[model samples]
Target: MDVCLLYFEDCPNWKVTDRRLVAIAAEHPEVVVRRKRVETMEQAERVGFRGSPTVLVDGADLFASPDSAAGFSCRVYRTADGLEGAPTLEQLRVALGLTQEVTR
Candidate 1:
């Protein structure tokens, strides 16, 4: 699976998502994590970037919503704990079609 993490430079939450991806990649060798920097609004629009830290799996948005629009901004995720800067590790696992497991 190819997981692409799209984000801008200023967003603080991208790193959080990156860490989770790294953890997932460690456990699942088949998973490939790549980062794409969306530097400008034009670039964001060109790639259909919903927001910073937008996680795309196999070229599709993993957390896409009808209301979400493409732009250069921070993305919020609705996790089990409520709205968060990024999705939890377990969430990523499930999104990637992996069994739920405790992440270190």
Candidate 2:
């Protein structure tokens, strides 16, 4: 699977997301995560970048939002705990279909 991590340099949350993505990718051999730096507003708009640390699986946003406007900004995630800078590890695993059902 082609996973792209879109983000701006100024966004601090991207680093956190990147680390998690790396760890997840290590577990899934088919997953490949790429970093995309959105430097300009026009580039952001053209690439459909909702905000920094936007996780795109197969060129589509994993957690797509209809109301979100494409631009260079910090992205927030609604995790189980609360609003977070990045998605939780479990969230990533679930989104990427890495979670396997235990049959015991």
Runs with alpha carbons beyond 4 Å of true place in candidate 1? 100-104
Q: What C-alpha lDDT values do all the predictions have? A: 0.89, 0.87
Residue range 75-99, candidate 2, lDDT tens digits? 9998878899898888887788788
Q: After superposition, how far is residue 8 of candidate 2 from its true place, in Å?
A: 0.4
For model 1, residues 1-104, the per-residue Cα lDDT tens digits are: 99999999899999999999999999999999999999888888787799889999999897889878898778988887789989888889888989765344
Work out the TM-score per prediction.
Answer: 0.91, 0.91
C-alpha displacement of 102 in model 2, angstroms? Answer: 14
- Per-residue lDDT value at 5 in model 1: 95
Error of 1 at 50 (Å): 0.7
